[model samples]
Target: MLVPNDHVDQTGSQASAVRDADAVVRRCRERCDQTVAANEVTEAHWVARITAIAKDEDKSAFAEVFRHFAPRVKAFLIKSGADESLAEECMQDVMATLWQKAHMYDAARASVATWIFTIARNRKIDLIRKNARPEPEDLPWGPEEQPDQADVLALQQDSARLTDAIRQLPEKQRRLIERAYFGDLTHSEIAAETGLPLGTIKSRIRLALERLRHSMS
Candidate 1:
C-alpha cells in the first residue's frame, strides 16, 4: 500500500501512452497548494511509478520503494506470528526479489500493489513455516547454520522486545496466531483444530494480527 499506485514496473504500453501517463501522474498534485491530492494516493498511481522506476535501474527509486513498503510488510509478518528477527529477514528477501523481478509485473495481469503484496504474503508464510512445526521425517535438510556476528547481536536485542510484545496479545489471538504462523498452519487448519467455524477462525486471525501489529508498534 505504501508504494506509488502506478505501473512503472509493467510493460507493453505504447510509448506515447507511457509518456502521457507519467506526465499526468506527476501533475497529480493540487497545483494551487503544491501538494498531492488526497485521492491521488490510490494504489494504481503508485504501481506505475514504482514499476517504471524499477525498470529504469534507478537506485533511489528502488530505495524509495523499500522505504515505503518495508515497514508495512514487516508488520504483517510480525503480526502473522513471525518473531521480529524472522520478519526482518523475510522483508529483506522480499525486497530483494522485487528488485530482481520487477520486470515480471504486468499491469494487464494484476495491479502492482496486489502483485507485490502476494509476494510478501508468500514470503511471510515461508518464514512462518521455517520456524514452525518439525518436519515429518528427519528429511535431507541441512543443519542450521551459525548466525553472523552482527545478526546474533541484533537477534538477541530484537527477540526480547518482540517476545514481550507478543506476550501482550489477547489470549484468543495469541493462541490462534501461534498456531497459524508459528505452527505453520492456516485459518482452516486452526478452525479444524479448534472446531470453530471457518469465518470465525479467519476473523479472529485478522483481528488478532491487526491488534498485535498496533500494540507492537
Candidate 2:
C-alpha cells in the first residue's frame, strides 16, 4: 500500500532536518581542526625563534621575540596590578631575562609564551618585594666637608661597634645581612645566588638586624 501524501512529506522533512544538522556538525569540526592546526603552527614558530636565540645568540630572532612579547608582557603586568611605569620596567627586565635564559627553556615542558610569562610573573614579584622595603641607606662614611678630628674618631668608633655587632650574629643570619647590606644584593638576588627561599632570607636578615640594633643600643 502507498503511504499517505502528508506522511511522505513528513518523513522527507525529518530526513532533511537530520542532513542539515550533520552538515552543520561537519563544518564546525572542519573549522575547529583548521584552528587547531593554525595554533600548532604558530606555537612551533615561536619555539623555533626561541631555540634560534638559545643556540646561536641570534639578535634578529631576539628582536622579533622582543617586539611580539614586550607589549604583551607590559599589558599583562599592568592587568596584574602594576602601574604603567612599573609595568614598563618589569616588561624590560622580563624581555632581558628571556634573552639571557633562553637556553633554559624546554619546549617539551612549556610553550614559549608560558616560559616568558612565568619569568614576567617572578620579576614582578621580586620588584614588588624590593619596592615594599627599600634598601637600607649606606653607612655615612664620608661627609661633604672635612670633619673635625673628634667627629672622625666618633664615626670610627661607631663603625667599629657596628662591625662587632654584625660579627656576633648567627652564621646564616650574618651572611644574609652582609649580602643584603654590604654586598648590595636584593633579596631576590640573594635567593637566586644562595638557592634559599625568599622568605627565609628575609626572616634571617630581619632577625639579624634586630640583634644588631640591640647590640648597638
Candidate 3:
C-alpha cells in the first residue's frame, strides 16, 4: 500500500530535522574538543616557562610571566579592596616572589595563574595588616576617652545611607557586589561559581563598585 503524500512529506521533514540536529551536535563537539586542546597547550606553555625559570634562572621566561600576569595580579588586588598604590606595590612584591621562589612551583598542584594570584593575595593582606598597625607616634599618651555621641551618630547615619544605596542597586550589580565583598570571593572564584566568563565578572563588579561609590559620595 502507498502512503499518503502528506504523510511522506511529514516523514521526510522529520528525517531532515534529525540530520540537522546531528550536524549541530557534531559541530558543538568539535568546537569543545578544540577549546580543550587549546587550553591544555596554553597550560603546558606556562608550566614550561616556570620550569625554565626554576632550572635555568631564565630572565626571559620570568619577563614573559611578569608581563602577562602583573596587570592581572594588580587588578585582582584592587578588586580585593586595595588602593591603586597598594596594589602596585603588592604586585611588584608578588613578581619578586615568583622570581625568587620559582623553584617552589608545582605544576601538579596548581596552575601558574593560581600560584601567582595566591602570592599576590597573601602579599596584599600582609601589607594591609602592616599598615593597619598603629605607629608609636600615633599612640595615645593618656587614657582613652569615650567616642563622641555626635560622631557615633554621624557614623551610623553614613552606614544607614550606604545600606540604603546598596539596596537600591540593580539586582545583578547588588548580587555581584555582595559576592565580591560580603561573600569574600575573588573574581575568578565568582566566575567559576556563577559559570560566567572572567572578564564578564570583572566588568560587572567594576560597574557595581562605581555605582556604590557614586551612591556613597
Candidate 4:
C-alpha cells in the first residue's frame, strides 16, 4: 500500500530496496557451520525474514514471526503474573504492536527477539496497570453475565455455563482453577507464587475440583 504523500519518506530509500537477504543468512551460517546444527537456523535468518515483513507488511513474514515469537511473549507475560487468558490476549496485542511498529525496529540497536520481547514486556506492564481495580487493585480477571442471562450462541452456550461454574469457586480455588486450566504458570511456578509446598498445592487443586464439581451439582 502506498503511504499518503505526507506520510511517505521520500528522502529514505524505497523500503523494498532491502538487499536480497536470503544469501546473507546462508553466508553467516556457513561460517558458523560447526557451531550450528543441521536443523538449527540462526536468529540472524529469522531477523532478516522478520525485517522484510516489518517493512512490507508481508503476511508470510509476519506469520513466521508469530509462529516463533508468540509463545515466547506469552511465556514472558505469565512469568510476570498474568493469568492465562490475559497472557494469551496480551501476546496478541504485542504481536500487533510489532506489526505496526516494525519500521521503528533497528537491528543496530538490538536483536529482533530483544525488540519484540521488550515490546511484550512493556505491554504486559501496561496491561497490569490497566487491569488494576482501584486503590487496593486486587481483582485479576474479567467478569461476565450468566449463560442464561445472554442471547447465547449454540457454540458458546456450553462454554459459558462451564466457565460460570468455574468462576463461582472460592477465591483460592478460583486461582488454582485458573492456573490449572488457563496455564499462565506451570505447576512449580504456581507453588512458588502461593508459598505452598508443591505437593500441597497439587493436593489442594485436586480437592478444589471436587468441591467445584459438588457446587455445580
Q: RMSD in angstroms, all models? A: 16.7, 28.7, 23.5, 21.5
Task: Look at candidate 2 and tell me the lDDT of residue 182.
Answer: 30
Ranking by lDDT: 2, 3, 4, 1
Candidate 2 or 3, higher TM-score?
A: 3
User: How many steric overlaps does candidate 4 have?
Assistant: 0
Q: Select the stronger candidate by lDDT from 3 and 4.
A: 3
Deviation from truth (RMSD, Å), model 1: 16.7
State the lDDT of candidate 2 residue by residue for 1-217, as single tens digits: 1122232223443344334433443443443443433343355456557756876798988998898899999887876777899889889989999989887664433457767867876786677676533333432212222112222222222233334455566798767754453325665666544332334334433454444345446
Clashing residue pairs in candidate 3 are none
The candidate that achieves the highest TM-score relative to the unseen native structure: 3
Better of 1 and 3 by lDDT: 3
lDDT of 4 by residue, 49-90 (tens): 555675578888788889989998888778677889988998
- Give the TM-scores of the predictions, in the order they appear: 0.45, 0.46, 0.49, 0.44
Better of 2 and 4 by lDDT: 2
RMSD of 2: 28.7
* Model 1 whole-model lDDT (C-alpha atoms): 0.51
> Compared to the true structure, candidate 3 yields what TM-score?
0.49
- Deviation of model 4 at 124, angstroms: 1.1
Give the per-residue lDDT digits (tens) of candidate 1, residues 22-139. 4544543233121222223333444445555645766777777788788977876777677889889888898888888776554333334455777787676555467643423321
